[model samples]
Target chain A: MNITGLETLVFGVEDLAACRQYLLDYGLHAAADDPNRLLALDGSGVELYPADDASLPSAPNGCQLRLAVMGVADEATLQAIAEELGKDREVHRVDGRLQSVDDAGFAIAFQVSRRQPLPLIGEISNAPGSPIQRVPNQLGVVAGREAIQPRALSHLVYFVPDLAKAERFYVERLGFRVTDRFDGVGPFIQPAGSLEHHTHFLIGAPAFMHGVEHFTFHFGGPTEVIQNGSRFVKAGYQAFWGPGRHIFGSNWFWYFNSPFGCHVEMDADMDLHDNTWRPRLAPLGADASQAFLLRRRDNWMPGPGTPENGDYAN
Target chain B: MPKSPTVPNCHAQPLCHLSELGEGSARGFLPDEDGQDRIFIVCHEGRLHAWRNACPHLAGAPMAWKRDAYLSPDGRQVMCHAHGARFEPDSGLCVHGPCLGQRLESVALHISTSGQVSLADPHLTCSV
Candidate 1:
């Protein structure tokens, strides 16, 4: 399976206007011809449909990821997937795309990658013994700036009632590998085509909670995550988690509450893993979570009798 | 500059002497009587810097694993044991981790001419 990465995600939302605005506020570019489709800065994006639309297929077992479409390296890979999937599960070719359903009931699609190489301006930083990222006049950061756009869809997380069965289907059938595991929790699985730490993370959860936990987009660096997160906060969006680094993938993250009943995250600087790397199992705890956590600051005032009294929250 | 005695009738209090900490060591300082608020002073590359002991990620939980052991194995950066976030020595800017653009709340400090390091202002507090 030469699955490169996430190509697009189809969302069945309740409110069209609100979801469109939410994607825009999150720094995604919506198509002018079809407002229902939202594009990331990289041109790949998400498509939205009405929740009760009959055209949509039923969810496998109450999952938010209505249809997860992935890009393949070439048509040969697509044909290969179609042939392999056709053996037992009924595979359909619709609009030049192969569609099938995994054992867990999540819809899957594969196509020759429409992904393009988008050139983005990189962000820089200054650290001890490292070259200065910004010159004297060129400031690295500013207060209350414009929204930061996301580069591409990084990954998605799913809550599954049967962890063992879900892991087996992805690994044995779809050619995904277990990059890491959380004891009694789940596994971080990556496809054979990409070197990203994990393209999909499966978490063990109750059947009632079986749905998409959250999905994330990659940004330039930590600066983008904080700046974008602050802008989202200022816009009155609730923050779910983050502004911290994860110990497993080593990415800077910030998660925000969405109207879709799931979290949306902006992440940067995730570690790249190869076959040479050995997967380690760690018990998930606060100590095993993020390296350091930051509080959401809108305006912080000092206590009485401080040096100077003003707002330092940004 | 000549050495001056500790000023009386003010909130500023001496934290420790510069010689007390090595080039890569840290100590936690409790500001209020409640003992819930903590500040850690670290010696990074022979310079003194301090930050709130709480990580910005985990609801302001203490960043250290054990008492005052904040440095990574290389002893170059201050690491939060809860999530493995690392911050710079002087600027307290998180170079990599969850709180990338966010900085540690820095407590103003004044080193007296007599080598006494004291809080520049005791009234300063990080709001939750």
Candidate 2:
């Protein structure tokens, strides 16, 4: 399978107005013809519908994520996926896309990728011995840069009841490769066509917990992640986890709670792996997952409000 | 006489006007250092119920998709959006998701005749 990565997700939300505004405030552009559909820079985006909409698929576990639409490299790849999945289940062609469901019962679809190539460079560092450096007089960050847009739909995580079955379906059937694994937890996988560590992750849980865990978009880099996340917090969204770097993918992350029953994450600068790499397995833990954790605080200086203990004051 | 259970020191903390929380609405309060609420109140079916913001599934895990969004979208159930655990709004019993069979920690609430809603005992964290 020449699947590139996630393309779009459809969510059935009870409060469509709030969900729509939330996506727009999170920097997604409202589709010109359809304001309810929002897109990122690469054209990967989300479509929202009322939870009671009959056209939407039923989420077995009552999750808001109703369908996942993946992007493949070409029409042949899409057709191949359709034929493969069509063998044991119903695969329908609608709106030039092949729609089906994964082994774990989540609705899925495939389309020939229409992602627009990004023209900008990622955030650059001024390491002493590094070959790439910003031109002289170029500031590391500009004041009030344009609104940060997520570059692409990065990945999706699913909580499944049968880990082995889910992993086999993706690996053996869909040709997704295991990039790494968390001991007693799950595998991080990427489809054969792309290698930004993982485009999907599966966590094993009981049947009652079967649902989407989270989904994220790739930002320009860590600065964008922090800046956009802080802006989101200031806008009254609740922060869940992150504003930290992950050990496995080396991506800077900040996760926020969404009206959807799962988290939405901003991620950047992930490690890209190829066939030459081997998977690493480590115990699931805070120490193994994140490089470090930090909390948000108000800006301060050693002036009027400084305590008698000075900088040492808690 | 049997010995009574020792209790923590308690103090009254006024929260908000009863009219502030509209029927079928929720709000969070007492933000900690990290800006997470330590407790929340829900006005459901014309009665005010309070619970610690912590979800039973994870220690100290605050339960809101957004600030004061402690209930599901339809205003029927309390939801810990951390993992989609749904609890009964009036009873605080976990009805779905990871913490099945568990219950939210409830706090006693005192509503004055003048419509002041306060913590019955702010320091007395009680289990449901």
Candidate 3:
């Protein structure tokens, strides 16, 4: 059951208009729109539907319904997946795509190929003594005003109660491999074709609401996270957490509150690995998960040793 | 004993001792002159600062819900618990979360040797 890449992300939003506008403000291009549904594209497509819309599949709060399309080297590959999946679950054909529900209740969709290249910003580095010295400059001078474009849908996270069962289902049945693990905590599983840390993450917990934790896209660098994050703040959007670096993927991130009861993150320079890479298993602790946590600082004042007194000259 | 008017003017008096506000905590006070809502002040680093309690994001009242406002674990950032937006305490600039690079409104404060806290807006103080 090998999956290739993320095909589409489905969300149940309260206000279609507001959600649509939020995505547009975040720089996603609206390619298709109707009264009940909207398909937004950002180098890739994101499907949005009303919370009570019956035509679309339903996911619990904090759970995400992911469509992992298979990268078939040939037509025979698609036929193989359909044949294998059809043996156990009721596979439905819709809009020339193969759909089925996995054991974990996530609606899975398989297709030949639907992903397109995203307009990613070029790599940039800061010179010595620059304010953004350690961080990469993806957003450049576009902070606090324009929306920074998202490069690609990077990853999706899900919280599940039973990690063992979920792991078995994805690995044994769907051909996902455990790229890494948090000791007894959970496994970071990736599809055969994906080079990311994990395209699909299954966290362990109790019987809880299943939904998307957060979805992310690759930005050019840390500067983009700050620039785009400031832009969203000025636009009256609530920021959740971040513009911080995470230890897991080692990507600089900024998370924004979305209408979908989850967060949308802007990330960049995520570590990639191949089969030769050995997975590290560590306990899920805050110190082990994040390299550092920065608190908000007063940007209005100079440093403690600055010559100018605490007064600012207008 | 009868309670004073629901709206007590803090400006009529010079400075009030507000002990309920802990270090790095903030509370709203009635307007001093114009009846506008002003914020009371305290910061983690012992430096006093004040500003309107309203969060620019969604015009939401920040710290309205107690236990939702505080400095992050590191004590260098101000964290809004509702959405996890972290602001740099000194600069008021949001370095992480949704409001990156945007700053909170900074209000000037003067702390006396007797622990009396006074609001000192340069514009209002100059005219006086």
Ranking by lDDT: 2, 1, 3
Task: Tell me the lDDT of model 3 at B36.
Answer: 21
User: Residue A233's C-alpha lDDT in candidate 3?
Assistant: 58
Q: Across residues A45-143, which tens digit of lDDT does each residue of candidate 1 receive?
A: 888998778777678443445888888899999988988889989899877779998766788888888877987666777666776466667878877
Output the lDDT of residue A42, model 2. Answer: 86
How high is the lDDT of residue A131 in model 3?
63
Q: List candidate 1 segments past 4 Å from native.
A: A131-137, A298-314, B1-128
TM-score of chain A of 1: 0.91
lDDT of 1 by residue, B39-70 (tens): 88888777789888776755665665334656
lDDT of 2 by residue, A1-314 (tens): 99898899999998999889888878899988998989999889999999999988788778889999988999899879978998999999878878988899899988899788989899998889999998899878765788889999999999999999999999998999999999989999999999889999999989988998899999988889998988888787888887999999998998888888888999999999997889999999989999997776563568777655443322
Ranking by TM-score: 2, 1, 3
Expressed as tens digits, the lDDT of each residue in A203-293 for candidate 3 is 7755543545677777777777666766665565655556678787787877765654456777777888788988888898767776765
Indicate whether candidate 2 or candidate 3 has the larger DockQ. Answer: 2
| DockQ, structure candidate 3 | 0.04
Interface RMSD, candidates in the order listed: 15.3, 9.0, 13.3
TM-scores of chain A across the candidates, in order, are 0.91, 0.96, 0.82
Candidate 2 global lDDT? 0.86
lDDT of 2 by residue, B1-128 (tens): 22123322134657788889998999997765456777899888988889998889888677887789898887899999888889998899999888889999888888888988888875553221
